[model samples]
Target: MRKARWLIAVLILCAGVALSQKASGDDAADRAAFEAVCGSCHPVSMASDLRSESEWKETIEVMVKAGAKGTDEQFEAVRRYLRQNLTNVNVNTATAAEIAPVLAVSEATARDIVKRRTEKGNFRTIDELKQIPGVDAVKLEARKDRIVF
Candidate 1:
């Protein structure tokens, strides 16, 4: 009985280790997909800042239109990886580079945002984003959850 119990305990421990490793391996695959697909155009850091899942989807769509290539599975993996790693960023204090990717806006728009913030102080609410020229209020409203003041 003692020997049987010891064997059972060892088997359980081994199974746990195996399961943990499999989870890590899945994460590694997602990271690989992210690097292979998105890193082709820009550094992985470009997508490291947080955005809502919807925002990520929109960004991915734009990238596809812009000639970024990847399988649907790979794109899904990259999106999942981005969603898991990136979270909400404070737009009020974020740089143009940081805001561009996270907000899924043009670099010019990001520069405008930074410039506006510099001139007018921090944004008090998402509604104020409309004050910036070329910012679509409807789109900004859709992504409000990812934008923080």
Candidate 2:
């Protein structure tokens, strides 16, 4: 059944292409969702790719409950989009530029954050950002990803 084998191969090839397209479609959807909503409050490049599905879900919930006005469906979309796009591994030190965009803080403030962190030496954990005058626990959590050592 040479004809049957050929048909099966063609179908398999088509299926593979469809699967790739579906993955890319999901990425496009996530990017669109993030751009439409999160773009207002957060700098597009400020936040990290993502940590995990659950992390994104919880973070979105926190933002919405705090003041963000996106619909539940929209929020979910944002969460999914962020989760897919923003998951990073390096977490020890941070740059002022990286910290500034996410916190709505000034470059001066970001420099201060660096200064304080430098003075204190390496941070043993994320909570140490609180030692910086203008930084607080919530703010630290927000920028923890960009920080290391």
Candidate 3:
């Protein structure tokens, strides 16, 4: 009975790990498509610019017209990723995933933002956010309109 219980516990742990990996894997695939399609013409770094879903859709259409190569599914993936990530983020509540693309920062920087928010409380301004190590002041300034406390 003890062995059976231990085996069940291990299996549950493994299943939980697998589920989390699958979620990250889907995001990874979306990110890959975004990079490949956008990076083909210019730096994928451009994706960091905060935009509404409509604006991103327009930009993607223009890129496609300019011969950005991607299948419909790939383009859709890019659109979905941008629409989801490159939007207004509440510093008090956003996850690293949401903050990273909107601020044009790395995942590490975004995680730092989250850590700071947890430790120091909700950020009230761009200056407060900039105090976090790894966050770029310039990028935060540029995307200030997309940030909320």
Candidate 4:
């Protein structure tokens, strides 16, 4: 009985350590990507402020337009890092302006989202976002976890 209990505790401890290490690895990768791409042009501090995912996307777009050289994967990594760290908008309750920056959609699309919500009701599922005109299904899928009911 004593040996069995000890073994169980050891397994639990190992599992916890593995999970912790995985989380740290993810953070490290995001940090590395952020530094390598975004940090190359300006202080990483420039991105420290919390912004909506849409806002981060816009920032990345502007940087690309201004000739910030990076592959699509690198730009995507930076965008994901920013979105995970910064986005806090609630799609169910936010105004068009608030939704625009968080979802990386144009103001017109944001307005359409709001209009649909108003005409129908509170969205019960992320999939319901498809009802909005001009919403990209792939983009919405990528943001599913971050979105609030």
Q: How large is the C-alpha RMSD of every model relative to the true structure?
A: 13.5, 14.1, 9.0, 9.8
Q: After superposition, how far is residue 146 of candidate 2 from its true place, in Å?
A: 10
lDDT: the better of candidates 2 and 4: 4
Taking all chains together, each candidate's TM-score versus the true structure is 0.58, 0.46, 0.59, 0.57
Clash-forming residue pairs, model 2: 49-86, 49-87, 50-86, 50-87, 92-147, 92-148, 92-149, 93-147, 93-148
The number of the candidate with the highest TM-score is 3
Worst 10-residue stretch by lDDT in candidate 1?
A: 80-89
Tens digits of per-residue lDDT, candidate 1, 26-145, equal: 989999999999999889788766675567778888989999999989988987677556645577887776677556678899899999889989989887878787787887776677
**After best superposition, candidate 3 residue 148: deviation in angstroms?**
6.5
Best by lDDT: 3
TM-score between candidate 4 and the true structure: 0.57
Tens-place lDDT digits, model 3, residues 13-131: 99999999998898899999999999987899877877655567788888889999988899888976785567677778878877787787899989988988888788887888888
Models sorted by TM-score, best on top: 3, 1, 4, 2
**Which should have the higher lDDT, number 2 or number 3?**
3
lDDT, each prediction: 0.80, 0.64, 0.83, 0.78
List where candidate 2 sits over 4 angstroms from the true fold: 49-67, 88-149
Task: List runs of model 4 lying over 4 Å from the truth.
Answer: 91-149
In the range 7-61, model 4's lDDT, one tens digit per residue, is: 9999999999999999889777877888888777789887776666566778888
lDDT digits (tens) for residues 54-98 of candidate 2: 456677677667677766677667766653346332223556755
